[model samples]
Target: MARTARGFAALALAVALFGSSGCGYNTLVSEREAVESAWGEVQNQLQRRNDLVPNLVETVRGFAAQEENVLREVTEARSRVGGAATPSEAIEASNQLSNALSRLLVVVERYPELRSNQNFLRLQDELAGTENRLGVARKRYNDAVQRYNTTARRFPTNLVARVFGFEARDYFEAPESARGVPQVDFQRRP
Candidate 1:
């Protein structure tokens, strides 16, 4: 009777330790994967936007050839976006691209012909849709990062996270320049 009781107690202790650790580890892994998958979606949307920008730029250029500075800025921003390798880097690059594009779009308003052209109008609509999709993807990525960070920082899992080196991830956030509406100045040309 005494031997049987001791064996049961030992088994129970092992099960308890394993159960807690296993749950914590598995949850961390699942949440990290969710964040990764979300990041992939963000990258895809960014690529789509990058692909669409040249067409828009070209269309605008045909009508407003003198807006060379604005066009060059957009081209530079798009290039930076393609070069970004990490999430934080990507966020910064994407925000710059957004700002540059916003400026380009604002400039477009100055050219009634560009705005009214069928090709330009269609490209503008597509770019607008792509921006909306990109916004959603960024939201999803941030949500996933929140979940993973929350899980990694929580009790029990925090210990597991440390043990496994599952660090927190950066959320996709817009910079100040990208957050507000682009300022429009009807009085000047730069």
Candidate 2:
């Protein structure tokens, strides 16, 4: 009777431990995966934007070879973005690229002929679409990061996260310069 009672006590302890751990463990795993997947999507959209830059640059070059400084700035920014090692670095580099592209667009407005070119128009359309996609992906990544960080910081799940070495992720925040709406006056002369 004593031996049977001891066995039952041990089994109950094991069951309680397993039951408590299972939910927390699974939540951490899934949240981490969500962050990873979202980051991948952000990278994908950035890559698509990167791929389109050169073609767009070449098209602009044919029309406005004199805008060397603007073109060079865009090219250099693109290179920085491509060479970035981490997410923060990539975000900073991408912001630089965005600024350069904005400058290039302003320069494009100065050349009416370039704006009318079929190739330039097509590339511009594709680039605009890519930028839109990048925005969506960045938002998704930030949302995922928020979710993961929340899970990692929460009481019960945080215990599991700590045991498993899961850390909170940084968010993809917009730069200060990006906070303001860009003044794009298409009707006004550049």
Candidate 3:
């Protein structure tokens, strides 16, 4: 009878251990998935912005072909963003694209007719909306990363994360140059 009782106790201990580990493992998996979903959203928004670029460029080009430097910069920046292999690289390339787009907008301002063009106006509005979406996605992604990183670094769960090779993700940070309020001069030339 004592031997049978000892066997049952061993079984209960084993079950408890397995159940505890399973819970922690599942939580880690859930948090990791949240981070991935957020990252996917950020990428989706970025892609949407990228898809709108060509239309924007074409519309502006029809009205401001002489703005070759700005156009080339925007094109090259877009290419970099498209080919980026990592989050950090993507962020850097995104900043370059943003700066190029800003320059393109400034050039458009110089040509008042471009601003009045129907297609240009439409594309500009679409791009602005896409940019807003990207901002929201980026915020969501950062929030997810913060949660995952914090939980992954905490006690007990960190052990499971380490065992499962779940590493923390990098946050999308805007470049220092792009962090300031954009300057816009509204004075018309005489």
TM-score, every prediction: 0.87, 0.86, 0.84
For 68-185, candidate 3 gives per-residue lDDT tens digits of 8889899889999899988888888888999999888778778777777888878888988999999999999999989888878876667777888989889988888788988755
lDDT of model 2 at residue 129?
97
Better of 1 and 2 by lDDT: 1
Instruction: Sort by lDDT, best first.
Output: 1, 2, 3
Better candidate number, 1 or 2, judged by TM-score = 1
Candidate 3 global CA lDDT score: 0.84
- How does each model score on lDDT? 0.89, 0.88, 0.84
Residue-by-residue lDDT tens digits, candidate 1, 1-190: 9999999999997677657777899999999999999999999999999999999899989989999999999999999999998888889999999989988978987976666699987887898899899999999999999999999998767877998999999988788877677675534444
In candidate 1, the residue pairs with backbone N, CA or C atoms under 3 Å apart (3 or more residues apart, or in different chains) clash, namely none
Candidate whose lDDT is highest: 1
Q: Model 2 over residues 6-37: C-alpha lDDT tens digits?
A: 99999997677657777978888898899899
For candidate 1, give the lDDT of residue 51: 98
| Model 2 misplaced regions, further than 4 Å | 1-21
Q: Any idea how many clashes model 2 has?
A: 0
Report per-prediction Cα RMSD to one decimal. 4.4, 4.1, 4.4
